[model samples]
Target chain A: MQWLTIYKKECLESARNYKWVWVPLVFILFCIMDPLTTYYLPQILESTGGLPDGATFDIPTPPAANVFMMSISQINTLGVLVIALITMGTIAGERKSGVAELILVKPVSYTAYVTAKWAAHVTLVLLSIFVGLIASWYYVQLLFGDVSFIHALSTAGFYGLYIIFVISISLFMNTWTKTPGLVLFLTISIIMILNLVTSVFSHLLEWSPTNITSYLPSLLRTGEVGQDLWLASLFTIVTIVLLLFGAIQTLKRKEIV
Target chain B: MIQLKNLTKTFDKQYAVKNITFNLPSGKCVALLGPNGAGKTTTLKMIAGLMHPTSGQVELANGVKGDIRKYIGYLPQHPQFHSWMTGMEFLHYVARLSHIPKHESQKLAEQLLDRVGIADAKNRKISKYSGGMKQRLGIAQAMIHKPSVLLLDEPVSALDPIGRRDVLNLMEELKQETTLLYSTHILGDAEEASDEILLMHKGAIVESGSLQDVKERHQVDKITLRFDGNMKAYKEKMEEFPFVTHTDIQKQKIHVYVQNVPEARDVLLELVSKEQWPLLFFEVGQTTLEDLFMKVVNEHAMADHL
Candidate 1:
């Protein structure tokens, strides 16, 4: 119940700061622009003076489902950056400004305080992804061919988990440092390192969470799930839980000075 | 009532508050008197459970088991709030965190706003609030849970005179409801507002007692005489009087410590009239808290010097 109250305050703060509006706008813009440009690539290229006058090149227009999946893939990098940027300051800024001390000085439990922040960030990330995915579904169907609504929903759900994973890292880093900028830099750097390792050693790192980001688009195009998808997701879910738990313990041990 | 047992906090191999113990009885306003860096804030934070002591414990009188925080309402020296929030919203949020019912929180927040005299600005954003208004709002939020012990750290040290008077009066009324322990360096405010005093120096308590008791313990019979003439010469002449046990010159005033204040006063006045000394003022009373504070702090400094 105490967690719920804190969650509401967090949401209200986000709403007032225009985070709820602009973050989804960034997603919707990326999703809309991806499909619209892909559909008109041939004409857009020809108009730019086709390959040194008289040389012509063919550009393939993929299926609507593929275009929608491509947009999700683009969101893979930019979306993670957005999530890290917003979540970097949630805990660190409060602690720096002494607001955390005031709140924790009350009867509020450490678990309630940290978990509420985690839930709020997860809620906002999930909502923005849902809205952006729906908008992209409309644009892809209009410009290219047919893609099922259920396909988009499942893609959003899978990718939303990956985004929540990013948010969890930001929250964990926030507890470790007082500088929000450092939280942002460290979170992005860690994710980038994981992504690079997953690509370079795919078989060895099959059960890694970063593998899920690379596999989600293919899963949407074909009705096939990667062999390690379940294992990777299990790891991601467990990691998210562990990270939140680590955050709570860190906050408990590092009471305000 | 709250009992602090051997409370000690050390940072980076240095003691911020060291091996201090005191009990705060219920329904009394005790002032923790100390200069800056005397560890008053650290001691209060330890009691508020905002900081864990390197050693020792703070226990409530009832011996209640879990989470001593619910029973303590602490206002830091500089209170920081969510500046984007309205006063009403902040208080309501605090009340909800304390597990007050949603419907009741609104009413309680409003009532507290009126109690703290910030009701008029309840709807305004806290970013626009003046320092004193924020201090009052901080006090209101701390009391939202109706905690048994209210620990305020330098509540009025940052306020102007009017704001200080307002907070002092509010504290006077509040002591009737809960045990109030606040820290301050302003001796005059403490003298006017508190029932007891705890004088801390160099991270340890140097003195602790009720206002009357501490004063009586260090009581003296003295006459203070000020003149336009040379203060050292007057001090020398005054010391020769038989009733005048000793004398010291301070700020052009002669403090004549005597065995008998009445006999000393009569003799000093007669000598002044006969010699036509330029006596600017004459005061007969016990030593003020300012005198005691300087004496005690200087004594500690001299001890540390050795």
Candidate 2:
């Protein structure tokens, strides 16, 4: 019950800070930009007049699925950074600023505090990603060809897990340090290392969380979920639960020293 | 009521607060008094449950079984709030955290705002409030749950003189409602506002008792003399008296310790009259709390050095 109260406070604070508005706006912009550029590249290049005289370049229109996947890929880099940057300060900054002391001194449980924050961050990220996927799906249908709504929905779900995993990393890092800058650095570094290990051993890493990224776009292209998708999803979900539990324990141990 | 049993905190093998024990009786105003870095804040933090002690524990002595923090309210040295929130909004948020129902939270928040004298500023953003207003808001937020014990660390140390008076008056008004244990280095405020005093030095309590009892325990029989001219010659002359134990001058006033105040007062007055000394002012048997604080702290420091 207290967790729900705290969860509502976190959401209100995020809205007050315009996080609810701008994060989704950034996602939508990234999603829409992908299709617009893919469709207009040939004409944009021809109108520029910077190419050598009589020089020719053939640019083919990619499938709607490719455009949608490209939009998500664009989000995979910049949008992840935006989410991490926003979440980096949620715990670390509050703890350093002494606001955490103000709240934790109450009767509230450490689990409630950490869980409420985790839930709020996950909700915002998932909602924004879903809205972005839908907008991009519409643009792709108009400019290219037909891509099923189910594919877009599945893409958001798989990729949403990856984003939530990133958020978990931020929360875990937050409990380790009171500096937002340090949290951001550590979360990004951990994510980069995970991605590297997954790519270097793709054939062997069927259970790796980063495998969900590759499986998502392939699902969009082939219209069939990969055999490894469920394994990777299971792995990501388990990691998220463990990381959240770790953050709660870390906070309980730290205790505003 | 609350009791701290041998609580201690250490960082990197160095004690931030050494073993400290005390009891806060219900409905009493206790002041934790010390200079900066004397562990006053650390002691308060441990009691507030914001920091855990390396050894010992803090528990409610009122037969409460659950979390002691549920019955406690804490205000830090520099209380920070979400500046974007209005005064009323912040109180409502704190009320919700304390699990007060939505229907009653608004009424409690409004009442607390009026009690702390910030009701008119209820709708104003916290960021735009003055330092004093912000401090009042912080107090209101801490009291939302009507906790049994209220812990404030240096509540008025950051305020202007007027703000200091305002908060001190508020504390005076609030002591009747709850057990108030606050920390401050301002001896004058402690003398004015608190019923009990815990004097801390170098991370340990050097003295603790009711205000009247502690002062009486350290009380000295002495006469203060001020002259129109140089007081050093007068001090030397006074030191020659058989009953005078020692003599010290502060701010041109000679403080002469004596064996008996009644006899010393009569003898000193006779001498000043008979010798026709230019005595601008004379007083007897007045030992200020500042004098006791200095003497106690200096004595402890000397013992440490020895």
Candidate 3:
């Protein structure tokens, strides 16, 4: 119940800051541009080329599933950056500004405080991603052809798990650092390193959470779910839970002075 | 009532509050008086459950030992609020955190805002509030839970004269309804507002008692006299008197500490009459808390040097 109150406050704060509105706007904008750019590339090449007398250009219309995959890739980079920017100050800012002392001095539990922040961030991430994916699907249908709604939704669900994983890592980093800049730097670095290491050593690290990002595009393109995808999804969910638990412990022992 | 038994807090292997023990009787306002770095804030934070004591315990009136924060209201020396939140919103948030019923929390927040005299500005964001207004809002939130004991750390030390008076007046009114304990370096404010004084120096309670009792214990027989004639000659002559133990002369006034006021008064009057020295004013009384606080703090400094 107390968590609910705190969660509402977080949501209200995001609304007041216009993060809830603008973040999804950015996402939807990126999603729409992906399909529109793919559709117009041949015309753009011809207009800008001024090709020599015998030069020839051949461009093919890509599949709608491929357009959806292209949109996911765009979201994988920009969406993660947006999520990091939004949540970097969730915990550390409160501690730095002395607001934590006031709230913690009450009868409320530390678990509730951390969980409320996690839930709020998850809500925003999921909402923005859902809207962006649906918009991307609509644009793909209009510009290219029809893509299966179930496949797109399933891909988004799997992909949303990876975004939640990033958000939890952000919450954990915030608990460990007092500076929001440091939290952003550390969270991005950790995710990038994890993704790079798992991709390089894919034979050994197939079940890593980073695999979820790779599997997202393939799942949307191929319309097939592999055993590796199932394992990676399970690993991503477990990692998020563990990160939240770690965040709670770190915050419980945090010194507000 | 609140009891602190051997409550101590250590920072970096050094004692901030060391084996301190005291009792605050129910419905009485107590002032924790000390100089800066005297561990007054540390002690209050410990009781407020904001900091854990190194080796002791704070037991409430019912003898409940742990997690008594719900029953105590605390205001830090410099309170911080979410600048984006309006005063009413912040209070409602705090009241809800204390688990007040949803319907009652709104009414309680309004009552508290009015009580703190900030109801008119309750709709304005806290960032727009002045320092004094923020302090008043701090007080209102601290009292929102209606806790049994209110712990304020240097509540009025940072305010201007008018702001200080407003907070002090609010505290005076609050002590009538709850057990209020506040720490301050201002001896005059403590004397004016508190029923009891706990004088702390170097992480220890050097003196603790009711205002009257502490004064009586440290009181000395002293008389202050101001003259209209040559002050130097009068000071020298008065210093020569046998009953006069010590004399501090400044300009036209001389403060004479005596062994017995009656004997010193008779002798001084006779000397003044015989010499026909012009006199303007005279007063005799015990030492004020200001004097006592300075005496205690200075003695501690001297003892440290020794």
Candidate 4:
């Protein structure tokens, strides 16, 4: 019961943060970007005094889902950045700012305090993803016409988990240092490193949730859960669990000095 | 009630607090008094459950120790709040942390803001509140749930005279229900507000008990003497006077606190005649709190110097 009070307070605070607003706005903008680029590039080239040669072939019809598909990369970039930025302060900011001393004076332990904080970040990321999905739905319906609800929901769900995974990684990152910026950087840098490694070294990167960002959406594309299923499942579950456990343990032993 | 038995806390292989033993009976206010860096805050933190003692244990006299935590409200020295929150919001958060229901948390939050004298700025962020206002809010947050034990660490530091008066009054007001123990560097504030004073020095409570008792035990013989001319000759003459332990001369005045003040009176008069030190005033009295503090601090320094 008491935990719910803290959770509610945290949720309200997340709502007030501007990053929550920026997440959906940026992602929605990114989602519409590919379609706009596809629609205009041919015209732009033709206007440039016709291809400069007699042999100019027509551009292939890109898939109507290209705009929505671009959301994958968007999620890995802006989504991960937003996740880290929002959750960087999950524990370290409070500890560094000395607010932990104020809050811990009550019956609230460091465990409950940090758990509620991460819960807030998760809720924010989830809400932002939901907002982005609504905007995507509007744009896809207007531009592509009739996106499968299953595709949209599954894609949104996968991205939601990815965002949570990013935020959780940040919460774990907090234990290493007490700076919110540094912790957030570590979260983004780790995700980016894994992403780069998987793209360049397929055999080396197949061990973890390397393809979850790219492959999770493939589940939506095919309406089946085959894209990096084993790796994504293992990585998402293990990363979240390990990170949350690490966050809880680090916070539990945190000294307010 | 709160009892700490052999409570000692060590940090980085050094004892930050050692052999702390005391009991705070319910409904009484005890002051943990000390100078800067005296481990007063450490002892308070240990009692507040913010830090664990390396040795021994703290026992609540009435309820189970764990249960007692539910009834404890702590105010840190530089009380920190969520900077983005209003005084009302901060109080509400604390209310909820204290397990008040959502409805009651909001309701009590308003009432507490009023009680702490910040109801006017209930919607403004805490970062914008004045220091005195912030300190009051800190106190308000601590007492919001009406905890049974209120441990305030330098609760009145940032308060002005009127604010200090109000906070002290609030503490007195809370005495009917809560066991209050606070630490402060402000000796006068402690003297004015506390029934008992725990004088901490070198990570240990060197002196404690009723304020009057501590003062009485450490009282020095005091003499205020006024002379017409410079007190230089008189000061030098009184240094050799029988029973005169020490003397400090300031202009035409001589301030002396001696071991045998009664015996020094006649010698003082004789010195006035011999040295032609024109006397304007001569008086004797008991030591004040400031005198006791200086004596205790200097004695410790002298002992360590040896």
Q: Please, what are the lDDT tens digits per residue for candidate 4 over residues A1-257? A: 66676788777675666655776677667656665666567787888866867786788755555557665566667667766776787667877877777787677855676667778777776876777666766666676666677777887776677677777788888866779999987888898797888788876665466566666556656777773665666778788888788877876565555
Q: Which rank order by DockQ, best down to worst?
A: 2, 1, 4, 3
Model 4 TM-score, 2 decimals = 0.89
**What's model 3's interface RMSD, roughly to a tenth of an angstrom?**
1.2
Interface RMSD of each: 0.8, 1.2, 1.2, 1.7
Docking class of 2: medium
Model 2, C-alpha of A91: deviation from truth (Å):
1.5
lDDT of 4 by residue, B199-233 (tens): 88878888888998988887888788997756676
- For model 2, residues A1-257, the per-residue Cα lDDT tens digits are 78998899889999999999998998999889989988988778878875687876668888778888898888888888888898998889989988888888888888999889999999998899899889999999988989888878877888889889999999999999999999999988888898899999999999898788888877887667777998988899999999999999998888684
Each candidate's lDDT (Cα)? 0.89, 0.88, 0.88, 0.77
DockQ of 2: 0.76
Number of backbone collisions per candidate, in order? 0, 0, 0, 0
Off by over 4 Å in 1: A46-51, A63-66, B225-250, B254-282
What lDDT score is found at residue A154 in candidate 1?
76
Model 1's CAPRI class is medium
How well does each candidate superpose onto the true structure, as a TM-score? 0.92, 0.94, 0.89, 0.89
Best by DockQ: 2
Query: Could you tell which candidate, 1 or 2, scores higher by TM-score?
Result: 2
lDDT of 3 by residue, A1-257 (tens): 78999999999998888988898898898788889988988777679965677977667898898898888888878878888888999989988888877888888888899999899989988998899989999999899998889889999998888889999999999999889999999999998999899989998887899888777767776679988999989988898899999999987776655
